[model samples]
Target: MQSTLERASHWLALLCKIVAGIALLALLGVTIADVSTRYLYRLTEGAIALRVIGSVELVSYLMLLSLLAAMAANVEKSQVVVEAFSHGLSPNLKNRLHGVYLLGFAALGLVLFIGLLDSATAAARHGEVTQDLRLPMGPIYYMAAVLSLLLGLRSLIHALLSAVFGAEGEVSHGE
Candidate 1:
């Protein structure tokens, strides 16, 4: 069971990376296209108008936000340090500290997750959009909210598992 869960988490993490990469690629393409078109227009029309280009830019910006969220999910995993006193501390204390860290992460994630959902709903109802595109911003907000919620759930699950099993290296006290 544990192995399965670990495998699933690893796959999900990989999926996030792939998604981030795709979003970044799309952003780059849009940016290049927008710039080239504007440059050509400026040479011919005597001034650059970025209306359509700006719409693309808005999408690009949203993509950037998505990419950052994905990257954070992955980078934060390894960067999460619970080792305030790992080497010199007893095994049990170290495990407890790790559990505490996991719980903290879960709490943070929960807060962000709930707030994001509400924000997304409000944005949708308001028909919010970027000034250039006038495209609905609700979808982007929704995606972000979902991603954050998943991250939170993942952290919470990890916390529970660690608490039950102790650190990876030590024998679990209960079982």
Candidate 2:
């Protein structure tokens, strides 16, 4: 069961990384296009009207998605650590402490997932839409909720692994 879960988590992290990459690429593309169009319009002195409508809305949504999609992978690999504080601790103790820290991230993810779900429901009920693009807000909230749930599950799994298996490939700080 543990191995299966680990495999699943690995695949989940891969999927999330791919999604984050694509979203970031799209965000970059949108920003470039928006800026290019504006620059061209100015350079042409009103002869070219190539402004991208609702670019701000697109960028904001894409940024949110990219960040959220990266959360599952980041939960395991990109945690902030004060190595100075844990430098003297034994491996076992460090692993246990890391497990607790991961649990905090799990709790945060779970809470955000629940809140996003509620927001999705409310948006659907009220027919809420984006200000500029008029895109339905419910689906976006649903996607965010799914990503948050993945983060929570991945964090829980890592927490268990750290607590029970003594941190995987952990590096000593002062070594």
C-alpha lDDT of all candidate models, in order: 0.62, 0.84
Report backbone clashes per prediction.
0, 0
lDDT of 1: 0.62
Point out the worst 10-residue segment of candidate 1 by lDDT.
Answer: 166-175
User: What would the TM-scores of all predictions be?
Assistant: 0.70, 0.92
Please identify model 1 stretches exceeding 4 Å from their true place. 35-52, 55-60, 71-76, 80-84, 90-96, 167-175
Q: Best-fitting candidate, measured by TM-score? A: 2
Writing each residue's lDDT as its tens digit, candidate 1 over 1-175 gives 6555455555656666776777777777777777777788877795765534574556666585665458435522533444654668876666556656767666766787688789789989988887776767788777777666656665655565556655442222232
lDDT of 1 at 98: 65
Clashes, model 1:
0
